[model samples]
Target chain A: MPPRIAQIRLVSSHPQVYAPCDDSFALVDALLADRTKLLDHHPSICMEIGSGSGYVITSLALILGSESKNAHYFATDLNPHATEVTRQTLEAHGVHAELLTTNIASGLEKRLSGMVDLMVINPPYVPTPEDEVGSSGLSSAWAGGENGRSVIDKILPVADNLLSEKGWLYMLFLADNDPLQICLQMRDKGFGAKIIVQRSTEEETLHVIKFWRDPDIQIEGNEAVSGGKTAPQRGFDFLRSQISRLSFRETRQ
Target chain B: MRLLTHNMLASNIKGVTNGFPLRIEPEKIIEKPVDFNPDFLKNMFSKIDWKALADASKIMGYAELPDEVPEQTVVESDEFLRKFHHALLEVHLEEGALVCPETGRRFPVNKGIPNMLLHEDEV
Candidate 1:
């Protein structure tokens, strides 16, 4: 019998490519939790922005299974080595995705805009020197620079442009990335976001947040009048409490 | 390089806008039989650019696809779906160059892998 998700041995690797780690597992766990919604959504096209070792995307393909016959999968990475590793990984799993070695789907805009039904990203979210943001090899995989928001910031607008009317986006961010502010920014773009999975290790706290287009949220301004005022207030309070809980956990450790 | 993969590729040179459906000039092509999944083909019908796929198939020497997808509700036709599956998945380019339709830049394909890396000046 085949595994329900990607087996660790099947995930290919290269010296330069970032292998699957705690954050990657967290992202996969979030997808598993939302598998029911994803199946019902019936996405025609699914894409992953920064595929490293092809773990998350391949896992997603397996999770969807043959039920999603109509879905097309694509993945892109800045590192050429990562794409190669991803190809090997997918081949090992008997799954397939169109792999491209490009900078965050650069040439894809004209064709893919407003057509992608789902997008997933695990960006470089570790704060480092600004100059180190796009450095070579493995460093590029983790260096986010300035609160780890540089790459995440660039991805948001691109996601906004590429996502279909009913598209759903799942992304992982660190506590230092200031996820609450990121949620507000996406809110301004007519996206409703919720924290799907939260995990704190000794070194970092990872938050896997899912964003979907909300028409009511789009019409309402920063006042948060769309889902009624109470919902917005509750969201803010939840974020605040999560931040404090994460900080408290760290300090106690 | 599978045609399905080729269908999504576009040359990302510095100033090329219409770099879609990159021309496939195959030096060596191989055919390996893969299990036919009818539902997958049916799902892919609407997403594929039929004209571009027909052109690609014609170039790769498997011109079974029509200029436009048949209007006779062919999605349920096993014969049609098998042809679509063979053209999209089984045909492989072991060695080739994907020429940019707009800029004429040639990206080499070696060992079933495409090298889409660009130089700093080219980008």
Candidate 2:
């Protein structure tokens, strides 16, 4: 049978490279859940930041499949080893992506700014000591120091700059990382956020949030507070209500 | 790395502005077969930086693309799309180094991957 996503056997491994895990699966599932939306999105430039094994990005390309022929795929990793492994994985699936080894995306921001139409991330959401956040190799994969927001916070601004006016970003966030707060943060950036998929394993709970630019929502602090701007207020209300429901459900669990 | 990737890459060292179209120091250039899709090329034609792509193509030893950014109507032609597709996807940089324009930093490319990581000082 043909593989819907990437075959695990074909995924290259290194002692230091991070492997595909539950968070990765949940992230893919979130993309799969929104396959039709992705197809309709018609993203021309697609990218994945912190691409460990290239599983999520590869799966995303597959979900959109050959129908999305115009979309150019790019993946970046801090670890050079992860970039090599990612190349092998993309090749195994007969897909092509421009791979770069960099911290988040420092060098290419100018060229890529406001251009990426679809972006995905399976960030290091594991809360560790502050010292471990940017450690080299495998530890960098899951070390999210101090509520797991170190890398997440850094990525948010970059993602904001990279996303097109119609762009969509899918990212995995742990409950500990605080999904509600993340959603609110995105809301402040004039993006509408919703959890498309939420899964819990023995280790940790994962929420895969899909964010898109909502014109109705005003960018925080940029627009003056006005009672007449009910449309943007309603937009915030929607995000707040949706995320609050998630927190309530989690508390029940 | 293909010329398409090159068209979108720029140096991001601190205090370095206009770090685009990093100069190519090609060591091994190879052509890899890519599935041809004219529609994809047409869409990308709008997004890509024509001057950088043409310059990079010339550097990689393919000179089919025009020097100036052609009109969007030109992208509709099959001949134009073919050249656009070839320069964008077919040519690959199997091994080389991308030299940053602002700072003479060399980011090595091996096995078709570009290491854009900056050194501690560069960062």
Candidate 3:
């Protein structure tokens, strides 16, 4: 028989904060496998929103450090307990990062606005009814409201405001969820969104979805960033030209 | 949650219908390194909906797939196996949201975690 996936005990002060489930772990592993290619080049500032136990972000920091040396990750979570856990995890891994406790797109807005090169967020997209409000503590960490877009709706506007012109935003969501709508929202806000990874299972258990975005509203050819220039800025220029080309096409049409 | 699981998850709330392929509105999408096991990939071949996986992968900015899938026999081909490996095993979404099609519900993924909670009215 195949070896059972070893469950890692999540060290958290509040037991309510759940560790990443199996599928989540697998998704994270797959995304981080090719860190260099995914970022498209080097990113100066990388931020992870709602970092749980810091498993994924810390791993990313380590990989980025080893590969790019100049890249730095700033991770945040609403829960102080979770943030502390992430700090400890980063310390244990010998990876350096700036950890903070803030609600989604809170006080850090000014600090991060238009300065981030890459922003990674895994917000609560699950739809929760008002009656289920009692389950708020842990649930709040994950609940997305009636339409599941509550947090997303709030975040997108902020993401639009905060993201550097060429910055990339990566996210994970369920397919059963309305990713297209979110895509439309991103596009409407002049951001380009794409589904970068997907996993399907025979088991009827829960599924996870992931998405990525950039402000340049155009798909880029593999303009690999090898020199000292930041990937986001390069991507921004490429995307702008592409968008202009599309507009030119539309006008001709 | 795995893309497999995301494909299966739906909001079966009282009045809502057509819940499939939950949307991902991730706050962060990180890709962590994982050990590649060919045997595991082979075993999962039969269970996957290749078209869906391919389409989704393209949406995520990976477009190195062939138009038609090779025969199951081709699993041994080094080239074919490499493509499959990258498609199914390597991509990751560190942050984002998943929205329901019928009810338009959203589920958040933070760090690398997804929250599948439903509301009382939703139930």
Candidate 4:
């Protein structure tokens, strides 16, 4: 017998934000995938931005246990309705999570700067032209605008602002969204970026990218810090190099 | 509110970057006795911000966190597991205040409920 699929109703004001077919199940799979990777590192602080239904954070909270490494999971979504659903789901699972309803990168500086150790994002990355910015334009969750970099443009600068030294940033982007540009942008911000995983479908492409420090700077052979810890001095030098390059670009622009 | 919630929140208002790990300034905190679920506790091990939770727990007057997370050998110990369980799930944020780190806006919690409501001016 095949495994039975559970039909769970996920009520969202922006239903168009998610894939129309079996979103709940897709969410579960995404959660599991995220969980496996997160558990592999077991980061001290984890933040999930654009947590659509709270599945990833809730599932992480449930499976990782409250005590293991004294972990805390924060899930944020722009939609309040989605946040409410996330809160309900965690409560039902007897798991705890902090749910925030706000726009991407808003208010985070005042609250979380220099504190987070890991960040995960699955933003709207499909390219949309400037003229199309309304309901008929495209899915706000999937459309990335013109060059397919609008949301990434917004998020990258924030990642630079919020990510702690030696912290890791993970994101998923579509092939149409210009992964190379995204990588270049992150690298320009002084973060070492690489595609950790990818899955291509007939109509779309998905790639998971991990952004961190240059491997040389990481603390080698240290399993506790996920391979190695990037020293602050090297990180500063990298940042300086990036700033110099930016200044050169500014001179040209 | 619990540090778990604090870890995930961000200021998402337009033009403000760096929304993450919302800061917590607890005016009042209460530890309500929640039924212990070890399975649930065990399952949540990976998702936590350990240092933040431990720091917050200490601030709230419960300081049993070991210097480092013990090896798997000690994970099954009843004493070790119980201490971990109480710190994470048992403590409740009954009444307090959560202030956004960036904007300094205050969201009050009355009766275990955090009123994250924003005014028209805020929106």
Question: Among these predicted structures, which one has the highest lDDT?
Answer: 2
Whole-model lDDT values for every prediction: 0.84, 0.87, 0.56, 0.59
In the range B1-123, model 2's lDDT, one tens digit per residue, is 988888888987888886887999999999998888987787677779989999999999999999988887788888898898999999999899999898888889999898887778877
Q: Model 3 - which docking category?
A: incorrect
Ten-residue stretch with the least lDDT total in model 3 chain B: B1-10
True contacts kept of each: 0.33, 0.85, 0.00, 0.17
The TM-score, computed over Cα atoms with residue i paired to residue i, of candidate 3 is 0.51
Interface RMSD of 3: 15.4
What does candidate 1's lDDT look like per residue over A1-253, in tens digits? 5437888998999999999999999999999999989999889789999898899999998988787766778888888888889889988999877777777887676667788899999999999989999765888788999999998898898999999999999999998998888888887787888889999987899999999888666444556434555554566577768767876887788
**What lDDT tens digits, residue by residue, belong to model 1 across residues B1-123?**
778878767787888878998899899999977667776677677767887888888888998887876875776788888888988888888788999898898988866767777778987
Give the Å shift of residue B52 in candidate 3.
Answer: 52
* Residue pair clashes in candidate 2: none
Ranking by lDDT: 2, 1, 4, 3
- Worst window of 10 by summed lDDT in candidate 3 chain A: A2-11
> In terms of TM-score, which candidate is strongest?
2
**Runs of candidate 2 exceeding 4 Å displacement:** A1-3, A222-242, A245-253
In order, the B-chain TM-scores come to 0.95, 0.96, 0.75, 0.73
lDDT of 2 by residue, A1-253 (tens): 3438877888888989999988888888888888888999899889999999888878877877888887889899999889998998898998888999888987778878898999999998999999998777899999999999999999999999999999999999998998888888888888887778888676677889999999777778776566675765665677668667766777887
State the TM-score for model 1.
0.88
DockQ of each: 0.42, 0.81, 0.02, 0.16
